[model samples]
Target chain A: METDLFEQTILPHLDAAYNLARWLAGNEHDARDIVQEAALRAFKFFGGFRGGDARAWLLAIVRNTAFTKMRAQPAQDLGPDDLDKIEDTAPQPAQVLERAGNIEAMRAAIAKLPVEFREVIVFREMENFSYKEIAELVNAPIGTVMSRLARARAQLREIILADANLRETRS
Target chain B: MNCEEVRELVHAYADGELDVARSVDFERHIANCESCAAALRNVRALKPAIRGSYYAAPDDLRASVLRFPSSPDGVRQSGGLPAAERRAGSWLLTGLAIAAALILGFFVGDAFLRRSANQNLLAEITDAHVRSLAANHLADVASSDQHTVRPWFEGKIDFAPPVEDLATAGFPLVGGRLEYLRGRPVAALVYQRRKHFVNLFIWPGDHVTEIRDEKPQRGYNIVHWANDGMTYFAVSEISAPELRQFARDFTTALSH
Candidate 1:
């Protein structure tokens, strides 16, 4: 009976769990391991699921698992140079549109965003998660989710446009 | 709403997250202001583009998960021995018992392994197709024009995904999105047959070949194949024969 419940509640969300883990862990191997660990944790704590959005609940566990894994490892040496670069560019509307259809450019831009901003974009734009749901999942208030999503999109646009300009000159 | 207020609410307005009254006000402002309207369109366009780019879980991930003991306590229920006896057994005996179980499982489970792998792939893609529809995110780049939708995948994936308009053959091109299948990025082409939506996931295959199979799961018909260094999986709620026809037409179009 408990096995049936676990299968019904958690197994269906395996893609979502893997997706969140991939984004947070920054690669496939770590993401896979993290997802396995997260699933085990979810199974152990299945009683606490509380009849809500299973995808969001499982994703929260995946997010927490990824965070714990990251904390245990030393941070990458890529410094604040990217953040500094983002502040340097004054966003222009024409630039954003110019880079709009370039999916590769956009993916790279989003990948470079800070984790806080990146997760909001992944949850909102990619996953179609609502603001309130995002707040609850990420343990932030609604207002913070809104602002972070806004900031993430704006920064992503600027970065894509900047990359477009760089390519144009090189060509 | 003034430009400042409109700017603040633009994202919310584009997301359709605003309340009705606020939405009405937002629309009123957008209708009157060209710049704000353009900004809203950009916001709308950017979202689908982002949704088009995502990672799919590995193929075996689901099967491995399915094989995991259902409940946490199931791990303790190993070998049908009483909890006390199992814990009190000598460590060497426990190790030998585990090794024996592992060897037995390997030989006995080997026969079903191939079928399970196929089932897991079918389940994964079907679930992806269903989730795309359920989430109302079936197409990140929603355009009937193959020119517009096909180029949308450029740089998003490592290969150029074949996108064709099969409207002439009774299957119309809907749009496409980037999906991960079996651990790598693939392109998902959304097509429509009557009122039914078809999700065709394509990625680069190892060799040039043609193989087709029609499998039904939970009322959805899935037809998948690999051809000319590209793999395709077409899934929909339409009849299996209709989906097969769609696949044939798609393959013919790609060959040109």
Candidate 2:
């Protein structure tokens, strides 16, 4: 790949790369460093990247970098698998804040999701990558992508709205 | 499509990611099912909430990220000089470098009296102030250990800026370092005089010195004034009163 095209097309996605890295790293400094390293790798391996979902390809690199860092770290605080444990309780946004509500809880909810579900949500919801692009990026069958996305939305809905008594408490 | 099928694509439906037939079916479901309509609204609200968390890498990251590209600065590097223009361009660069040195000497002469220097001083200072805020390194010289902080600058900077134990006074000396601010290398004297960061940038420059003392950009209260043979810019997000106090200590550190 010529440097010019790489500069124009792929370079534009650095923020997307950083956003994914920030989530993966769970901090600002590491996220910044991770994206730079990922960019270099992506730039070097630009030839291997097929066109279409540049966002996903970048994300894949970020995921790899994040995992590499994760492996290198000493005992890590592994958050619970949110997707597996669907609370029977319903979601309420306002009340979540006052009673044991924090940003990490919301983040943990997103983070705990299954990777398949997480990827679809991050791409579609966070990065705004479309189904076709996500399909291309993750190298998934479009049906799998669609289903994962569906599951992701449903899961998010249940988790977000799970604090059923939030409105009552707020009122 | 059935209601179940229509519901499955509500996200796509909301995102306009659906095609003609699918969109029609999804809308029909939404029109009939009040639950689906409310679900759509709630889901839509999640987007903006999520967006609130989207933070950009510091503005200076743009320079570092896009630096090597044929950026505006890159254009300057790759000067369009035919053989005839080559000499003119070389002279321009040389003249600029010379002018920069003379200008820098006028302002930063006292602040930084050094041997030869490398880099674009103005851009680096600007870049440093910005990068510091982004990196949370606005103060390079941070320490409760006054002895450690003061002597630390011995090997690093040509001058020994005073390091005082200001923790009791609410200003603690953080560690100091040599960093590339704007584009030129400068002494990034860091001190946390309370919650705010004091980024004291010392480098040699005259042309951009005038821009010093310019009104603070954004929330950064900056005073760019040249002294001691170097241009110095002290910046912080702290209020004008606090920053000025920090600046006073910053300049007083130059006490020989």
Candidate 3:
């Protein structure tokens, strides 16, 4: 019966789990290991799988795993101290058309965004999950997800527009 | 609905996830309002751009994942092809397809040989890596947050992969990606060495498997070696030299 549930419910969310793991782990392999192990464990302890949202249940596991690894490591120095002045300058209409060609710059910009902003944006933007799904995945309420997404997008706009990391000379 | 209420649902709308009532209500409001309509258009535009930024993993990852058995070795395993599913037509069809592709891609000459219908495990591993990296669908759990991720491994594996904060080592731990390798789930610790990713696939290194040096697999530099009898692969888009350097550093960190 448990194996049946594992195949039916848990198996479907493997990709979702892997993506969330990759994002949390920052690469492919670790996330794979994290999710695989999480899935295996999630199955053995099927008692916890008393499902509201399987994706959320999986994500919560991923979040918990990432948090565990984070605690074991030494604290990282916070970036720039203040992320408020994140550059918000938009590209010139002409230049925008030119450099906006590739997705690389956009990825780099998003990578530079703070975690709070990045998580919401990545989940909302990349995963294509509903607001309700994301809220449940992050263990936050729907309103918080909406607000964070708004802030995240606004912050992303600021970062892209600001182009703080890039030099004006390049433009 | 007001602009704020309308804007919130715009994302929801772009996804086509709104219910019949709310969907109709929002559409009616958009019909009346120009600013809201323009905002919807702009928001919708962002979707493709955001998606485009993501690199989808190749089909093999999905194949391996689907082929993967979630049950324990105490149950079914993901190693090798299922006897029932291993038909000659699949391989023959694959071979014929590869041969057909070879003719069109004439420029790809001697450099890229025709892949045999029989999928090589090594090739599949590399394909899985590329496919995983290409897709935003890579990690089952995405976070730079290691805390929330590592514990999910407990009770599932007997060995720890020496997962730690390597930020001081210049590779800030990003998150983890789950991989099905060698019939078991191995944790791939994701870390950033500049822009490239190191996929440290760790499993208990027993006498069963032999380790090898970093090799260039399908253009991606792969550092496949064992430390503490554990297997790890640090793969990245960066040059082989840089990846090797990062791998050596990771090895040293693991040693201590």
Candidate 4:
């Protein structure tokens, strides 16, 4: 009965689980390994799962599993004061419009972000998670999620502009 | 609200996470403030561009997940064990599961290459469509406006692939990319049909033909035609009739 429920409730979120794992682990091989391990762990702890957001529950497991693997090589979190150092000048709307289609650059920028900022961006922008949900995922207050999102976008804009300028210089 | 407050609230506003009253206040400020409004637009644009990077679980991973260790007997056999013993057994079980998934992946990986080697035109087109969606590679020049998307192909492809916004007909022009098909570079125009994407591949060719019978390849609907010396293939996951409508409307739009 539990196994059936697990399949029905948690299995549908495989794509979401893989996406989070992929972004966190920063590679496909590790992502696959992490997700597989996470899925087995989730199954083992199936008895503890009360009926709630299965995607969130599964994703929380995925995140923990990825972090455990990353414990060996810790990722530095961005400080709140880092925003001051990151120039507040956002990419102009026109420049953003022109570069918006360059998904490669955007991907690179997101990948380069610190894991703390990167996760919030992924949750809010890609997964369309609410601030509350993002806070719950990261175990932070809603204010922290909002501020991290701001910093992430600020850094992303600068990184994309620098990349574009570098390309222009090269070509 | 002051500019500082608006700047702070813009990300929340863009994410639709702000409360109604705060959102209203933010909108009111942006109504009169150009910089604030531009900030809002820039924030909004970031969403879709980031969403484009979403990685769908690979087929093999998905297949392995379906076989995840949740079998009833497996659970029952281990269900009555002591707490410490169960913990040890679970680790053993987890090890077995990983081994099983790895073995499955190897076979699935083999089948994947074999499938790729024998892929036909329709198969290749469907793969390209899937690949575009896989890794934030949907478009080299993403835009909804035909004027913007059309000119982007200049000096890139040899010939102009007729670009038109089908938004009026429910299929909006999403963007364009330079795709290599038939061993040469071709123009791939992407359009949005509801949630699904329609990839229209175009290249210079002398083969003259009308819209052929819809061929469903690897679960994606394929519609192709030759017009005015250009070969076109429209591929999407939308229904056959809907894809036909897209082709007819697209062809009609190009003629004008």
Candidate 5:
């Protein structure tokens, strides 16, 4: 019966779980391990699921699992302070338009973003998750999710424009 | 609303997260303010472009997650008797109980060993299948023609991946992609069966052996075999019988 509940509820969201883990862990190998661990943890606690939006519930577990894994390792990417600084320097419209359609650059910029900012962008932009859902998943208020998303976009624009400028000068 | 208020809510408005009355007021304000309108346009344009850049989860990852044992205690319990029963029995009946326990332990140990090994491999291939679909990175060289797709893998991988157009058999060739499995690069052939996508991972086998096994993992039907110096794994969401037909058709085409 427990196995049936797990297969029916948690198994369906494997792709979403992996996607969240990949972004958070920043690589495939770590993402794979984290997701496996997260699934086990979810199964152990499946009885407590309370039955509302299993995808979000599974993702919350994945998010927590990934963070725990990240904390165990030393810091890797830009810290939260760097994200806050980038937030202040909003990119111009011309800059964003100039970098439009540059998929590789856009991807690189997103990858470089601090985890907090990167996650909100992915949840909102890539996953098409709503503000409310994201708030609940990330365990933050709606306002925090909104502002983080806005800052993430701002940071992405800044990085893309800077990279484009660097390429232009080299040639 | 003033520019400051409008700038703060621009993302919310563009995302349709705003209440209806606030959205109307927001639109009204943006209609007059040029910068606000431009901000809204930029935010809107960012959505699809970003959405297109999805990172596919690796297939092995999916398999591992799917096959994750429901509970650690469940595995332990399935392997043997409860702790109290074992201790009591050990004291009461030494002769017959020892013999029975030995027989049961041997079978249980053998089954557990074989299961863990098979589970590892199944997890890897299933993960590859799920990753391809999730990442939307199904094919590196996508073509229906055997001529174009077959030659594409010549120098890219160690072996020539057999690219066959199985359209006549109802399994239409979609394309082929490069995948890494079991520490070696293998060819993953994509085929369409109805709306489902079948990922057939092929690699050069060590010897000539005709082996076939089927397992259903996490609602996916996975058929694996080794034949004619090449190992094949056909994985999909299709039914077991249908997937078996696919595997048979694929092997026959390659052998001939």
Candidate 6:
């Protein structure tokens, strides 16, 4: 009975959980490990679930698991503190849009965003979660989510433009 | 809204996060402001490109996840992991379990003096309503017939939850599911109001704590009332007046 409930509530979110873990961990092998570990933790904590958004609940577990791994290897990704080190101003909007169409460039730009910014982007764009949902998922205020998403977009534009410039220079 | 305010809010305006009033004001300002209009376009441009980067789980990962609940000790017991990897995984799992236990202990200890006990109770009911909608697991027994839905709850719960088809009143009975609220099994009856879903949770109670005022939380309206030793909490995104009417109609129908 418990297993049936677990499958019904949690299994449907497997891809979502894995996608969040994959982006946060930044590698297929580590993402797989993080997801596996998170699944174990989720099963253990299943009894305490008082009924709410199952996808959000599962993704929260996945985020915690990924953060635990990242904590062990702090150098793996740029943490929130590293946000200031990157340039705040993006390149020209036209330049950014020119490069946005390139799938690989967009993917790489997203992969290069700081963990905090990357998460909001993934939640807002890939998962199609509302800002309110993103705030709850990240345990932050809605204003904070908005600013982080803005900063994430700015940084993504910068990265894509830089890629465009590098490709132009080479050609 | 001025250009400065519009600049700060253009992203939210583009993202559809602004409330209707603010959105109307924002559009009015943006219509005359070229820079603000450009800002909205710039923010909107990233969406389609970013959506293309979504990653799906690999087949092996799906297989492993499917194995998680079936295994007695969960996924850590799944085969094919190196001995050292399994050891490390179990160590991490142990650490997480201990941390979770500590958090749970703290919450249990602080469960008392929860500042207005009724508020917390309503919050739990609200959460269950959201869960029913979010999980798409609205009903364990899907039946529009009141007789079928009423008898379905017989052995699963200790109390008989009042069920009725309110279709004639513009709120049709859909189904009912067994839910756990405050550690007791309760019956959650699903009803449809236009495109909205109303979850009416009923459980046996001795006290008649009639809720005179409706409660609104997280964009959902809730109406709770007690009759004949059964407490009912009906939660939905529908208007409070309509939900209040639902409560009245439900009680009126049950009295017959």
Q: For all the predictions, what are the DockQ values?
A: 0.26, 0.07, 0.07, 0.36, 0.21, 0.19
TM-score of decoy 5: 0.54
Give lDDT tens digits, candidate 6, residues B1-256: 9977787777787676788899889989979977677777677666645755666688788777755543435445433334564565565665565445545544553343244346756887898898788656688678889999998766455567889999999899999876655434478999999999999999887778665445688889999889799988999999888999998889888888
> What's the TM-score of each model vs. the native?
0.64, 0.44, 0.44, 0.61, 0.54, 0.55
**Candidate 5 chain B — worst ten consecutive residues by lDDT sum?**
B70-79
State the lDDT of candidate 4 residue by residue for B95-166, as single tens digits.
576556645565655555444433546776887798788634688778998899888776555578888899
| Top DockQ prediction, candidate number | 4
Q: What's model 6's lDDT at B72?
A: 37
Query: What digit string (tens of lDDT, one per residue) describes model 2 on residues B16-69?
Result: 578887777777877887766765654554443343234445656545554422
Query: Interface root-mean-square deviation for each candidate?
Result: 7.7, 13.1, 13.1, 9.7, 10.3, 12.1
Model 1, span B1-74: residue lDDT tens: 87667777887876768998888888899789877776667666566457656766787987766554422332
TM-score-better candidate, 2 vs 5: 5
Docking class of 5: incorrect
User: Candidate 6 chain B: minimum summed lDDT over ten consecutive residues — where?
Assistant: B108-117
Tens-digit per-residue lDDT, B1-256, candidate 5: 8766778788887676888788778878988988778777667555534654456567666554543342233233322233553343333443244335445555555455456656756887898899789756687667899898888666445567677889988999999866755434467899999999999999887655444556777788888877667788899999888888988888788777
Give the residue spans of candidate 6 off by over 4 A: A72-95, B69-256
Preferred candidate (lDDT higher): 1 or 4: 4
Q: State the displacement of the C-alpha of residue B9, model 1, in Å, after optimal TM-score superposition.
A: 2.7
Candidate 6 lDDT at B42 equals: 71
Badly placed stretches (over 4 Å) of model 4 are A72-77, A81-97, B70-256
Q: Give the DockQ ranking, best first.
A: 4, 1, 5, 6, 2, 3
Query: Where does candidate 6 chain A have its weakest 10-residue lDDT segment?
Result: A82-91
What does the lDDT read for residue B162 in candidate 1? Answer: 84
**What's the chain B TM-score of candidate 1?**
0.62
